[model samples]
Target: MDPTLQELLDGIGPRLRRIRQDRRLRLEDVAEATGLSVSTLSRLESGKRRPTLDLLLPLAGVYRLALDHLIGAPPTGDPRAHLTPHRADTRTRLDAVVVPLTTYPGRLQVFKQILGPTSEPPVLVTHHGHAWFYVLAGRVRLLLGDTERLLQPGDTADFDAGEPHWFGPANDRPAEILHLFGPHGDRFTQPD
Candidate 1:
């Protein structure tokens, strides 16, 4: 292993100990919370034992620390900013460009979506966030909740993601659109 990696692993024990002490948590408490023996926790904190996923996952959950922070892995290379376009099943292609407008208590994310001819509607997935979309060209079929509408060029739509929503090409031609996804209770805006 690289010296840097070794050094990082060596320091995790002390870091874990410091974090635990900072939180005023006892080894026994952590052990009980994580189903680990107190001696095993001590060995882990003292660097006598290498931490593994089985050990770290519970500790991370208990301590409220991300696994990456717990293990001190080197920062990954820049998250690729450019999109890797996905071609649809029906001669259609999409380029989803992700843009973050702000990073604060709530994150605002945006995507520029382009769809080619015959793009089929993708399965609707529900996750944490609200989304809004605007069609710039061609037609878009918006499936939100129980309602489905065909948005002509220059049309726009928005809705809560929790209620389930999906969008794709409405015809045999390609379509292009801009989508904004807000996590902080922000609504989508469109021209009247």
Candidate 2:
């Protein structure tokens, strides 16, 4: 194998171990779930044995993760974005189609969000970032702190995410919006 491939393979053991530990799963539990022996799983995590797809597929399925996620594969250098719209929650009719408008490791990230009517009341959450939201379609009900506002098509709002906030479709219809956020909690300064 090439040196680069060898290095990638060498890193898989630690990554697998970390993922298992992060999920708080015991080695025996993973073995039972993956139909792999505990000794085999231990050897795989400890780098005593090389990983094969036969071993990885079952482990990935048991961990509820993609094989690429398990191995920490580098992002493919494709320029175009592939957006897969999936159900965000089982209880609500909300479906999220997320498209990353920026590359990884960027200070600011942009997302195009589509939210369907929620079945439950919105739960406000506070975090440490600044966020901007621009409604593209339908009406969006934004709950920012004690203020409640309805945003129509082309409406925009920006605020510190430290404030209690939540948003969704104002009616039974779907709402599409653009969201931009600073990962490090940096505020977006408006242009003069």
Candidate 3:
């Protein structure tokens, strides 16, 4: 076997551990999210298990990184970002595709969300967080408490997640937005 290949393989375990810790995700959290057992993750992180595509793919998604980047592959000159897209579960029957934009551990989670038109009525829920979203395309309808507003491209909104709030497409077209949120009330921007 090539020495470089062996060295790369050997380094994977520490890399995985570092990334997981950097993301502030516990083994149980990763297990629950990835459906991988805690023991498996431990073994992988401890260098007792060999890395494979099936195992690394989900980890890459969880870490919001490209497989090559995650494995410490040599950098190509390509500046394009590789992101994984997943559906946003809005509790009710809502259509939203969430693509993470940033992966700063324990910091604000940034995502580009595309919310499709939903025939169902909006259902608001309360939580402990603050969310700021900027509309990038189409139209968005933000229902906050008893008030609702239709937002267009370039419009921005921020609110306490504790408030009963919900967002959806303003019309039949899907609405796209850049969403920034922190579940622990971490403010991304200062008040004007």
lDDT of 3 at 177: 97
Please give each candidate's TM-score: 0.44, 0.56, 0.59
- Cα lDDT tens digits, model 3, 1-192, are 999889999999999999999889999999988889999999999999999988999988888899998989766665454488999788756899999887666778889999999899889888888999999999999999999999999999999999999998999999999999997997766789
Q: Residue 192 deviation, candidate 3, in Å?
A: 6.0
Quote model 1's TM-score: 0.44
Per-residue lDDT tens digits for candidate 1, residues 27-67, read: 99999999999999999999999988888899999999889
| Model 3: worst 10 consecutive residues (lDDT sum) | 73-82
Candidates by TM-score, descending order = 3, 2, 1
**Colliding residue pairs in candidate 2:** none
Candidate 3 Cα errors over 4 Å, as ranges? 1-81, 190-192
**lDDT winner:** 3
TM-score of 3: 0.59
Candidate 2 lDDT by residue in tens digits, 40-149: 99999999999999999998998888888889887778676556444455222345666666665757877788887767877888888899989999999998999999
